[model samples]
Structure formats: structure tokens, C-alpha cells
Target: MREEELSPGEPAPRAREPVFLLPGSVSALAIILVLIQFASTMVLNPDGQNMLLYWFAFQPLRIVASLTDPSLALPLLWTPFTHAFLHGGWEHVLINVAWLVIFATPVARRYGTVGMLSLFLVSAAAGAAFFAATTLLEGVYLVGASGGIAGLTGAAIRFIFQPVLVAHHPETGERLVLGRRLASLREVFANPSSRYFTIVWLVLNAAVPLMPAVIGAQLGVAWQAHLGGFIAGFLLVPLFERRLA
Candidate 1:
């Protein structure tokens, strides 16, 4: 469960909040995604857009085929990272970006710019790897930032629910929130809120593949990629985070 603590003291001078609270790295990444989508939709011709997707979007069949045909090796080198910048539509991109901001903000605040980007890139690649493994020989293309955002969501779960430590200044009696302690794996499961959130997230992804039958419409959701990214983020965040004393 999440807990907030405030030290007992007089209020300190208030600082003005900036108009744009998002970190520079997050803004840069979002702008790149938006620009790519804009170019795909408005700047590029039909053939050009198709070529862009063909070369950049992750294709399971391509990886499997590349095992024997070395000519396909070129795309295998980059598609895992590139696929994240491509999206099926504006709606898909917008939704992914919105989620990215929510989950990534905390990660960026805790892990800094490099760590944040590292988690995103590594998770995106993990997602591609999982998708390729599960969908071998299937002619399908995967694109978008869902995998990376899922990773951030999982990583955020590691510490977001922890209690914040607040200490008051002995001299001026200024309220200070010292820091947040990262939850251990055991503690995460032991905590009811985090445990239930994890369960719900897993259930939602598992149900994605069955959406077509339930709603009588095909909604392409790469649940495998999401799962892979989530696992990677949840397990690998400690590598990016600083140890608390």
C-alpha cells in the first residue's frame, strides 16, 4: 500500500510549478513518436509509407526466415528498436503516448534520463523477442510503444507504493520528505495494493487475444510483447536504480 508522510513544521517558500512538468527526455521521445506518425500519415506517399513499415515494423516471419536466408539479416538488426516508433494509427499512438507519460514520469524522476531511456529500449527489444518467439512462421507485423510503456508500468510498481520518509529540519522546522524506499520482491507481493494491481494487469493482457471473439471485431494487441516487457522492467529496474541506505 502507498503511504504519504509530512514532517511537522512551518511551510517553506512555494516555488512556481512549470507549465511543462514532463522531463526533457520524455518530451524528446514523445516528439519523435509524434513526428514519425505525422510523417507516415501526411508527408509520405502510399508506397513510401508501406516501405517504411515493411523495413521498420517487427515481423516474426522475417526473423524466422532470416535463419536460412542471410539477406534478411539486415532488418533483424534494427527492427526490434525501430518498431516502437511506428504505429498502426493516430489513435494507437496517442493512447500509447498518454500511458507513456503517466508511467514514465515516475521512472524518469527516479532513474534519470539515461536510465529511463535504457529501460524503455531494453523493454521494447524484449517485447519484440517475445513476439517473435511466440508467433514464429506467422505473417504479422508489430509496431508501437505499448511494449516500452508496459515496462515502465511494471517498473513503477516496484516503488510507487512504498512509504515516503519525511524528516523535519531541526533548526527551521521545515517539512521535508526524505525519500522513498524501493520495495523488495517479497514486500511487493505482501502488499495488497501492489499485488492486486499486478494481477489485474496480467489478466487484462491475457484477455486481449480473446477480444476478437468477445466483441466480434479484430483488435490487434500484442499481449506477448507486453508481458515480456513488463517482466523485463519489473526485474531489471534494480539495475538502473540507486541503492537506498
Candidate 2:
């Protein structure tokens, strides 16, 4: 567990593994969400569980109302946990899983196992809060992990943008070492193809909601969820590191 730093002057400690299977907690959550949605099909058909009613639609007043009186606000507050696990359809799940798997796993690895778990829970909560407070004000209901995923994005950006700090591992007393931190954000998308991939990601997020509104079709992107979660993740990343060994 010794994490001795090898860098002459580099700040952040690098992760040990090339692939962070567990870091991308989103993958598991994504699968779970799909499964939950699938299970719901057995009891409540997709059409029955309308996104407006069944999903964790973030509505601040409603959340407060629920806290004040659960009987009345049950619909609004209760879905926060279950909502992330539900989706509109296969295409919807696939898209979310794609972004989550591609971007989130690496982020998780940097944070480590416990850090990854924090990303899932905290980001999810953040997305729920943001949606409930903002979109709910507009009487719109939102469900999904986009907000939480956004936290992952923010966390990744922080890793890219901020100063790296290293410390000793607590249990094994591993010193901070090289190959721990993903070196640079710029390095990730240095490839022309990766640049396009990043662009596509940004564009898709912006476009998801727009398509449904403008085209009169259902696009159930839940972009608010992504934004909220990302913001939460951005904050939690440092906090999590502090707790790490």
C-alpha cells in the first residue's frame, strides 16, 4: 500500500491500473437502472410510469413539501433513488451507458474504489437536488443520472485543470507514486478522433432536449440530471481524495 511518489515535481499521484473496471460505477448503475426499468415493465408498463409522474422529477417545493408532509409529496421526493435506474427505452439507456462507460470509468479509477462509489451516490443526489430546485420551479419534472454524470465530468475536468496533491496511503502506508493520476486532460483528447468524440459528447447533451422540444418527439435526455451530478462530482472529488489513504 506504499504510494511513494516518483515524480520529480509533478503534483498528483497516479492510479495503478491501466483499466479501472470498478471506477466507472456508472456502468453498474447504468445496468441497474436498465434492470430496474426492465423490472418495472413487469408491474408498471413504460407508458404507465410516465416520466412526469414516476421518475425522480426534481421539484424543490415538492421536496420540501415531502419533507414536511410525506403523504402529500410522496410522488416528488420518493423517486430520487429509483429514478436514476429508470429510463424511457432501450435507446435512452444505451446512450447514457455509452457516455457513462466511456468518460466515467477513467474518472472513477483516478478517485479509486470508494471514490467511485461516492461519485454515484453524491452525483445522483446532486442531480436530484438541482432538478428539484431549478426545473421543478418551472413545473418540469426530471429523472435520470445525467446530473450525476455531469459531476463525473466536472471531476474529470478538475483532475485536468487543478493542481495535483499527493499523500500517503493509510492502511498499507503506500506513498504517492507515478502512474497514479491521469497525466493531462489535453493528453486524453490529443488524438484528432478523441477531439471529435468530445465534441460529439457536448453536442449530444445540448441537442437531446432540443430535439424533443423542436421536433415534437420524445427525447427524454434528462440533461439536468447530468448537470447536477457533474457539479456534485466536481465538489466531491476533492473531498473524497481527502478521505482516501
The numbered model that scores best in TM-score is 1
lDDT agreement with native, every candidate: 0.89, 0.62
- Leading candidate by lDDT: 1
Candidate 2 lDDT over 1-245, as tens digits, reads 86675677787755687663544455566677677667656667657666435445444556555666887576654566555655556776677777777667767666665776677667877788756654554655555556656767767755443335667777988877433343234744564544454567557765766786688998655666666676576556766653333
Off by over 4 Å in 2: 1-27, 46-61, 64-70, 74-78, 137-139, 160-177, 180-220, 242-245
Clashing pairs in 1: none
How many clashes would you count in candidate 2? 28
Q: How far off is residue 55 in model 2, in Å? A: 7.9
Question: Model 1 Cα displacement at 104 (Å)?
Answer: 0.6
| Residue 156, model 2: Cα distance from true site in angstroms | 2.0
Q: Determine which window of 10 residues in candidate 2 has minimal summed lDDT.
A: 177-186
